[model samples]
Target chain A: QQPVQSPQAVILREGEDAVINCSSSKALYSVHWYRQKHGEAPVFLMILLKGGEQKGHEKISASFNEKKQQSSLYLTASQLSYSGTYFCGTGFKAAGNKLTFGGGTRVLVKP
Target chain B: EAGVAQSPRYKIIEKRQSVAFWCNPISGHATLYWYQQILGQGPKLLIQFQNNGVVDDSQLPKDRFSAERLKGVDSTLKIQPAKLEDSAVYLCASSLVFQGLNEKLFFGSGTQLSVL
Candidate 1:
């Protein structure tokens, strides 16, 4: 099943901070995040694995709560380049790494 | 490393027509995925392949959609008798391995399909 994302849309000024949350009903083994601009492909952002292993862009950070089956992406001091749609893909062990994505959170960062 | 490649950046067809899109994954990548993204939603996984073999295709609309990755290199997704609701972006992504879901994926620009 697809995960759920909070805040369908958010507008922020440069240097602002925001948080996007993704929650899944089933237990997840990992969570992947991606950012996509208009007319472009979704770029890999970060991946949060069970047992606290995280990897991705150096500037971006995220947290995964294994017990809750939730993950959150933190955009701190947001840059104009951060303007895009963010998606979280949840991977379930039962599905053997198959990822189901959330509805996406749109972020608009203004100068 | 080169990124995943997809063909026909944009395609338009009438309802009930047929359309096909192609994808070339990065060199040596064994895992390939096809996703469908509606305008305001996230990309949904339609199928997944590991070295030319299907790993998952539970979400694919088998009645009208089909895909194949020949020789573990390139793949093609075909839609026969398309429906108006099939208008969306078809994204192709690849990962270096299929061991775990934590692997990062590189995506192609995607083929935008507009079914009238």
Candidate 2:
């Protein structure tokens, strides 16, 4: 099943901070984040593993709570380049290597 | 590295018509995925391939959709007798390996399909 994302849309000014949350009903082994600009492909952002291992862009960070089956993406000091749709893909042990994505959260960071 | 490549940036067809999209993954990547993204929605996984073999296709509509990754380098997704609801963007992505779904994926620009 697809995960759920909170705050479907958010608007922020430069230098502001925002948080996007993703939750899945099924136990997740890992969570992957990506950003997609209009008319472009989704770009890989970060991945948070169940054991707390995180890897991705140096400037971007995210946290995964294994017990809750939730993950959150933190956008601090937002930049104009951060404006895009954010998606969280969840991986379940039973599903093997398939990653199921969430509905997505749209973020607009203005100058 | 060269990113994943997709053909036919845009396609339009009438209901019941057939349409096909093609994708070429990164040179050394061993895993490929196809996803469908509707307006205002996230990309939904349609199928997954691990070196020319299907790993998952539970979300694919077998009644009208079929896909193949020949030679483990390139793939094609075909929708026959397409329905209006099939209008969306088809995205192709690839990862270096099938490492427990933890590897990052590189995506292609995607093909936009419109069914009238």
Candidate 3:
């Protein structure tokens, strides 16, 4: 099943912070985060596996809560380059390598 | 290393027509995936191929869409008798392995299809 993403869209100014949430109805083995600019391919940001793992890149961080079947992405000191659509792909252990993605959250960062 | 390559960046066809998109994955990648992204949405996996065999295609609309990754390097997705709803961007992605742990997917620019 497709996961649900919150805050369908967000507008932020430079140096602001924002959080995007992804929740799945089924148990997730891992949650992968990606960012896609307009007319471009999705770029991998980070992956949070089960066992309450947390991962970060620069000012962007993500946390996965296995018990809650949800993942949250944190973007701090947002920049104009951060403007794009954020997607979270959820994987289930029983589903092997198949991953389902959420609806995505569009972020627009302005000066 | 070269990224995934997809052909015909944009395509426009009338409803009931057939269209096909091609993709070449990064060298040595064993897994290839085809996804559909409608406007204002995330990429939805349509099918996945492990080597030359299909590992998952549960979400593919078999009646209208079919894909094959012959020889495990190049893949093609075809949509026949397309409907207006089929108008979306078809994206091709590849990964070194299919494992969920620490796996990152490399994607192509995707082919935007507009069914009129």
Q: Candidate 1, after superposition: displacement of residue A42 in Å?
A: 0.5
Return the clash pairs for model 1, or none. none
Score residue A3 of candidate 3 by CA lDDT. 97
Write out the backbone clash pairs for model 2.
Answer: none
lDDT tens readout by residue for model 3, A1-111: 889999999999999999999999998888999999999999999988888558998899999887788999999999999999999999887777678889999999999
Residue range with the least summed lDDT across 10 consecutive positions in model 3 chain A: A91-100
- A54-93: candidate 2 lDDT, tens digit per residue: 4546556798888888998988888999999999999888
Candidate 3 clashing pairs, residues 3+ apart or interchain = none
- For candidate 2, the clash count comes to 0
Q: Model 2 — TM-score against the truth?
A: 0.96
Location of the lowest summed lDDT over 10 successive residues in candidate 3 chain B: B97-106
- For every model in order, what is the number of clashing pairs? 0, 0, 0
- Please give the distance, in angstroms, between residue B36's alpha carbon in candidate 3 and its true position after superposition: 0.6
Q: lDDT per residue, candidate 1, B26-81, as tens digits?
A: 99999999999999999988999999999999899999999999999999999999
Q: What value does the lDDT take at residue A77 in candidate 2?
A: 86
For residue B65, give model 1's deviation from the true position in Å.
0.8
lDDT of 1 by residue, A12-99 (tens): 9999999999999988788999999999999989888889765546556899988888998989889999999999999988887788
Task: Evaluate candidate 2 by giving its C-alpha RMSD to the native, one decimal.
Answer: 1.2
- Cα deviation of B4 in candidate 3 (Å)? 0.4
